[model samples]
Target chain A: MFAKRHVISMREFSREEIDSVLDLAESLEPYARGGGCDALSGKILALLFFEPSTRTRLSFETAMMRLGGKTLSLGPTEGSAMAKGESLADTIRVIGAYADALVIRHPKEGSARLASQFSPVPVLNAGDGAGHHPTQTLLDLYTIRKESRLEDLRIALVGDLKYGRTVHSLAYALALYGADITLVSPQTLEMPDRIKADLAGKGTMVRETHALEDVLGEVDVLYITRIQKERFPDPYEYQKVAKSYRIGAESLAGARDRLIIMHPLPRVDEIAPEVDETRHAVYFRQSFYGVPVRMALLKMLIGDRLE
Target chain B: MNDGEMKLRVTPIGNGTVIDHIPAGQALNVLKILGIDRTTQATISLLMNVSSRRSGRKDIVKVEDRELKEEEVNKISLIAPGATINIIRDRRVVDKYTVDMPDLIVGVLRCPNPSCISNTNEPINSRFIVKSKNPVILRCVYCEQAIAENIADYLI
Candidate 1:
């Protein structure tokens, strides 16, 4: 169903399509772990990242490599033609000629959709500023499906909800799976009413709370996010608020043993390092799930030629 | 005629378009969408809050020498969904029809999100998917952000 289609937004995927990707990712986990596959032999994937990303870029590259496909990157923005004032459309058009599919991560919202319009090959949005990172959302779903069941599970999305693009897309996907969601954030960072309203329309049972500890005990999954200091006007206020949101061992005393903690990583003090040793920490494995999830996507979009 | 008589008598347009049954105060917005400003050479007349038998109160815009374009008419449908377009030639109504809101509104309205790629230097026109008709909700085809309220403010 994903053949040659642009993966720009989570809104584009229905429940069946999301389930299909997760199922495919489950099948490809063996190759993602150690084995090699020539599903996309000789295919070349292009990466154009206007913004800096470590895990996303690496996982995408690794996913392509594991599939017996080669990958090329535009490298740093300062060194690429983009530094010379080339538009994203021109760059996509030029690079699309050399690749089977294009993965773009830009700071501008809807940049991937614009690139798709100009690109000859399919376009996958790694991320666009405060927009969508469908691949991340997919991998996140894979992680949740792997560690814990999606249906009827209580998932609390903590930290920055208003500005955190990861949580925004993840929330919608979780709601689609019929997971009861609890939004834990500072009042300033509460999930937008529009998003909550949309979730409610989907028949999702949603709750909003300012304290993470309030819902940490009952939730099946604790999704923590780093409170971005840049989003706040006062640094002192950020430090104070950031401290209250930190998930440490002490904070998990009342948490259920089955409760798994997941975080989209490169985390800055949101999930305490000490908690990494706990049985609840699936975030490290969660980060690794990106490889297989992305592998499933790359194969679906461009693997037909090899067949 | 004095100011009082001028206010009482609304002039008819010759060889132009008459947009009647506008939602009362939206006549100015319709004019704005048609690019009728101080620089416009056409004789434009906007009658606001006129008593209407159908909708209680309505507005009308008469352009003496200009007819509205397709894109302009579509944008007018956003604010004045029930507005009727009357084509006037030689001071007589030649044709009349109600504006139909297209399923896809393209190049007519801007994406209100400042960070939207359409607002950037990309070589593309602004596109919105009409999600609702009665209230005129538009979802940006690119960003997927909904424009539910104050939609006319985003008209290009």
Candidate 2:
């Protein structure tokens, strides 16, 4: 078997591979409940983030610590040889020599892919521009499975699907397992046609709706995403679309008891804070479980023997 | 014969291959596309910055003892979509090959979309379903980002 060397995008994993990770995460809940540390003792994880982050960087660091491993966090784009004009290839080559494994975040569209090409170690993408985030999608999948059943589930993705890298990656993983996906957003914020066509090709039920209320009672999983200001050029455009897509308990009154609300966080109001109190609120758990799921991910990635 | 020894005479293509009306400035894009840039395997003759009756200034590459296949003709259509190709057999022109728009291209143009699904990790090969040919539009099989005609490149 080829070494599982890179995780630049979620689209790289097959349905079977994703299922395997979910199964590992299922068992990981015990570790989470028991509060054990040292699953990956003494291992070193290199976090090379050129862009600013909140949830992803901290989540991976927490995952490493909980596993009894060490982490080396590099600050955003300022401190490294990057400021001195070292090429991305040279940076990865130098980093690969020191770190056992590498996690990278860069502003270039294919930065993770480029890192994987040069780095000798496993290169995990923390986030790549307005592109894909494979690990985030994995936790999101695990969250959906834990909060509610995943197979054939009705999943409605709301907010900025056009610029939401999380939604783009998540929608494909949802389709890989055969979910009925309803993409609800403003016309300009609508799901890109490429993803729509892919779902259509797979015969996955997809609909574009302007109002979330129309689909509120109908969906099993309300996967909400925020308008990423960083993904847009103009702040004014971001401000205009931000108001229309908030998820609160008022909208959830008609939703199913089994319903789950999720967002790739550091949210800017697409999801109301009040929704976090509801039983349907799984975003925090989703965000929290990222630590353990990623623990399993890093362990699986680095080939550590697990009992 | 290879290298300079394998050269195409400047004489008018007596009834053979009609590499008609190549863009004078870009005969090199066509030559590079044909995999001739570094090869010393064949005798090469090129006409550059020449006046084309069809295109204002033109570039041409006439390779001796080389014939393009049907699939290759399709590729020629893409690189210089306006350029023409001709068949040469026994020093005689047999059939003229005209450039045509491609509906589903196998492997020539690269998808221009940086966020395209084919640009991702899954073990699956990349694919683009053609939406239009005129202003070529392609929908990536994975991410579903539609890359415009020139910006998106497609492969088999």
Task: Output the number of the TM-score-best candidate.
Answer: 1
Model 2 TM-score (2 dp):
0.74
Model 2 chain B lowest lDDT segment of ten: B1-10
- Model 1 whole-model lDDT (C-alpha atoms): 0.88
Off by over 4 Å in 1: A305-307, B1-14, B23-28, B35-59, B63-72, B89-94
Cα lDDT of model 1 by residue, B1-76, tens digit: 3546645678666699999999999999888777778998888888888877789888999888777776568677
TM-score, structure 1 vs. true:
0.91
- Lowest summed lDDT over 10 consecutive residues: which window, candidate 1 chain A? A1-10
lDDT of 1 at B89: 86
Provide the overall lDDT of each model, using Cα atoms, as 2-decimal numbers: 0.88, 0.72
lDDT of 1 by residue, A1-307 (tens): 5544778999879998998888999999999998769999889999888899999999999999999999999989999898888888999999999999999999888899999999999899999888999998999899988998888878999999998878989988888888988999999999988888888888886899998878988889998888888989999999999999988899999999899999998898888889999999999999999999999999888885446
Candidate with maximal lDDT: 1
TM values, all candidates = 0.91, 0.74
Model 2: per-residue Cα lDDT over B1-156, one tens digit each? 232432443654533344656666556666655656674566666777665556667666676667766565555554466777777777777777666655655444444666542354423344445676666665554334455744312432
